[model samples]
Target: MNNSNQTLTIKEQLQACRSKEETFKTLVTLSKILQRLSSEEKTDENKVKGCESAVWLIVEESNGIRHFNADSDAKLMRGVLVAILSLVEGKAAKDIQQMNLKVELAELNLSSYLTSSRTNGVLAILSQLQQP
Candidate 1:
C-alpha cells in the first residue's frame, strides 16, 4: 500500500459540513482565507479548461504527491472553485480518483446551485487531475 492509503479519505475530511448552509458558509470562509492571495503563486500546467469564465488550476508534485491551486475571475465562483479545490488538494492523484465527489457535493446540497453542465465541468476537472 502507498503512504496515501493510510491517510484520511476525502469524505472524512468533508465531515465538517453537514448542511448546505454550512457548506456555503465554509466556502465564504475559504474566500476570506484566499482573499489576499495572488493567482501567480498557484499555477498548475494542466489548467482547468472549458469553464465559462477564465479559470486556472495549478497542481504541483511535493514529495511525489500532488497539491492543487485554483482560481477564477468570477468572485463567488472562486469561492465555489476553492470549495472543490480544497477538497482534493494535497491528495495523491490516484486517491483523488477514488473519491465519490458527486455524492459528496450532493450531500453538501450544492447540486441545486450548479447547472448540470457546470456540475459536469467540475467533475471533469477532478477527472483531469486524476490522470497519471
Candidate 2:
C-alpha cells in the first residue's frame, strides 16, 4: 500500500492502525515515505532535537504555503514526525504558528505510545518552524 494518497490525514492514518502490529506497520510506512528526501534537503536547520533518534525537516514557506520535508531513523520516531506533518503541512506559517502540536497529539491519542523525549522532539520541530 502506497500510503501517499493525501486523502487520509496522518491522524486518520494513525487511527486506522488499531493494533500494535498495525501501528508498527504505519511507522515503517512513514519511514519509507520520508526516506525519499535528498541529503541536501536534510540539515541542522531541519533537524528535530530531543528525539530518541535522528529526525530532520525542511519547512518551505513560499507564497503563503507551508510544505514539510522530513526524515527519521527510528521507525516509531517516523510516526512521531508524521504527527508533526499532520499539523502544519499545506498551511501558511501564520496558521502553523497558531497550531498547538500538544493538543493535536492528545487528540490523536499518540501520547500513550510516545516517550516524553520524543514528544519534546516533535514540539522542538514545531518550535523550529516558528522561527522567522
Candidate 3:
C-alpha cells in the first residue's frame, strides 16, 4: 500500500509483525517506501551524527507543520530513518518536541532491533527535527 493509503500507524504496522520473519518483511517494506533525494540535499550540513553510516536529514516547516527529508549511505539505515521519520513528519514542532521517542521506539519494537549507536543516531535525527 502507498504511504498515503496506509491505514496503520507506524506503531500499528510494526505491532502487526508478530515474528522475526514478519518484522524482516516489514523492514523491507519500510525500506522500499523510503525515497532517495538529490545529491544537493544530501550535503554535510544536513548530516546526522552518532550513526555508523552517513545519514542526512532536512526539515522544512510550512504553515506551522514540519516536513522531513532524509537519506543515508546504508540501505538498512535508510529504512531505520524512514521508521523514525514516520513518527513526527508533518507534525507541528510542539507535537514533535512533546513526543516520547523512547516510548515510541519501544512500541514499535525498534529498540530491540537497533544497536545503541543506531538508536542514538535516530535520536539525533529527532533532535534536529525538534529544533526551531
Candidate 4:
C-alpha cells in the first residue's frame, strides 16, 4: 500500500502493482477517488466524445494549474479516466500540452487488459485535456 503522505508519481504508482490483480485493485482505488469528485450536474457540456460510455470531464484552472473532475457511466471507464487524470491534474496547461500521454499509458502496460475502444477512450480524454 502507498503511504498517504507520500505522493507517488503516476509511473511509480503503476509500477508498484506487480500483477494484473494488483493493477485492477489500483484502478478500483482510483475509480473511488474519481467517484468522490463526480456529480450528476456535469452532463451536457462537459461530456467527452469518442468514448463508448458516457464520460464527463470538468477542468478548472487555478493560478495556471488545472484541476480535473470526471465521471463515467461505466466503472472501468471511470477507472481509466482516473488513470489519465492522475497524470495531468494539478499540472500547468503547458505541461499538460507537452505531456505524451500515449507513451505514459504504454508504460503503465494497460493495453494488454484494455480493449481497442477503451484505449481510444483514454486517448480521447487526453486530447480534451490538451486543448487550449
Candidate 5:
C-alpha cells in the first residue's frame, strides 16, 4: 500500500494499543511484515551509522518512485525501521523529499518511547533516506 493509507493503518493500530508492551508487540508484528535483507545487501554502503545495533537500508528508485528494504540485528530496531520506512517506501522521490520524518514519528507517538540514542539512530536513517 501507498504511504497515506499505510500510515493511517499504522496510526490506527498504534492508537488502539493500551500499553507500551502492547505497542511493542504491535510494532513487532509490523516488523514481520517487512522483507528481510539478503546477505549481499548488507554491505557497508547500506549500513546505517549511529545505530547501537547494526542496521542496513537498501534504496532503489524507478520511474521517480523510491523503494526501500531494511533490516537490523535487533528485533525492536527492526520494528522501528519498518515503522519509519513504511512512510516512504514505494513513494515518489519528490513526495519523500517533502516529508519530515521527525514530525511523522512524533505524530505516531514513537519517539517519546525511545531512548535518546535510539532516536538519534532513527534520525540517522532518516538523514540518509532524505539526502538529495
Candidate 6:
C-alpha cells in the first residue's frame, strides 16, 4: 500500500497541470523528446498536408516495429506530435493500427489547448503514420 510504489499515469500527470502556462511549459518539455528530421529528410514527400504549420514525418519498419522521425516548424505542433508519436513509435505496425489515437489524446486532454486547425494537423500526422 505504499503510494511510492504506484507510478502516476499520463492522465494523472496531465490533469495535474493547473494552468495554461504550466500546460504549455509541459508541452515544450515534451517537444524535446521528439526526434528532429534533418533538412534533407523534410522533403515534400515527407511533409504532412492540411497543416497550418509545416510538418514532416518519416516512418521506417525493421523486423516488425516501426520507427518514427518527425519535425514541425511550430514548437507547439512539435510538442503535440511528440504526444501523438509516443503512442506508436517503436511499436509494431499492427499494434499501432489497432490504436484509436483520438481516444488516447482525449484521455490525456492533449487536444484541449489546440485550435481546430492544429487538431486537424495532428490528425494529418496520424494519417501519415497509418499509411503503408
Residue lDDT tens for model 5, 20-124: 888889888887877788899999999999988899988888888888889999888888877788778788887888998788877665754689889778889
Task: Sort the predicted structures by TM-score, highest score first.
Answer: 5, 3, 6, 4, 2, 1
Q: Which residue pairs clash within candidate 6?
A: none
TM-score head-to-head 2 vs 6, winner: 6
* Best-first order by lDDT: 5, 6, 3, 4, 2, 1
**Model 1: residue 54 alpha-carbon error in angstroms:** 1.6
| Candidate 6, position 72, lDDT | 94
Error of 2 at 50 (Å): 2.3
- Give the number of the best model, judged by TM-score: 5
Question: By how many angstroms RMSD does model 5 differ from the true structure?
Answer: 1.8
lDDT of 1 by residue, 1-132 (tens): 112331243234335667767666655655553433375554555456666655676667777678765666666557666556655667777777788876655554456457776766677666766777
In terms of lDDT, the best-performing candidate is 5
Clashing pairs in 4: none
Better of 1 and 5 by TM-score: 5
Model 6 residue 69 CA deviation (Å) reads: 0.7
Question: Which has the better TM-score: candidate 1, or candidate 6?
Answer: 6
Tens digit of per-residue lDDT, candidate 2, span 71-104: 7767777766676676666777777677775676
| Residue 116 in model 3: lDDT | 78
TM-score of each: 0.66, 0.79, 0.87, 0.83, 0.91, 0.85
> Which of 1 and 3 is the better model by lDDT?
3
Quantify all predictions' global Cα lDDT against the true fold: 0.59, 0.68, 0.74, 0.74, 0.81, 0.75
How many clashes in each candidate? 1, 1, 0, 0, 0, 0
Over 1-132, each residue of candidate 6 has an lDDT whose tens digit, in order, gives 111111234345566788888778877876776667789999999899999999998888889878788889888878777666666767788887888878877766675677898888888888778766
**Candidate 5 Cα deviation (angstroms), residue 28:** 1.2
lDDT of 3: 0.74
**Model 4 lDDT per residue over 1-132, tens place:** 112222255457767888888778777766776644446556678988888788888888889988877888877677767677777767789998998988877777566557888767777888999998
lDDT of 1 at 60: 74
Tens-digit lDDT string for candidate 3 (1-132): 114233246668888888877776777778777778789898778888777789988887789887777878887777677777877777788888898876776777665568777777777776787777
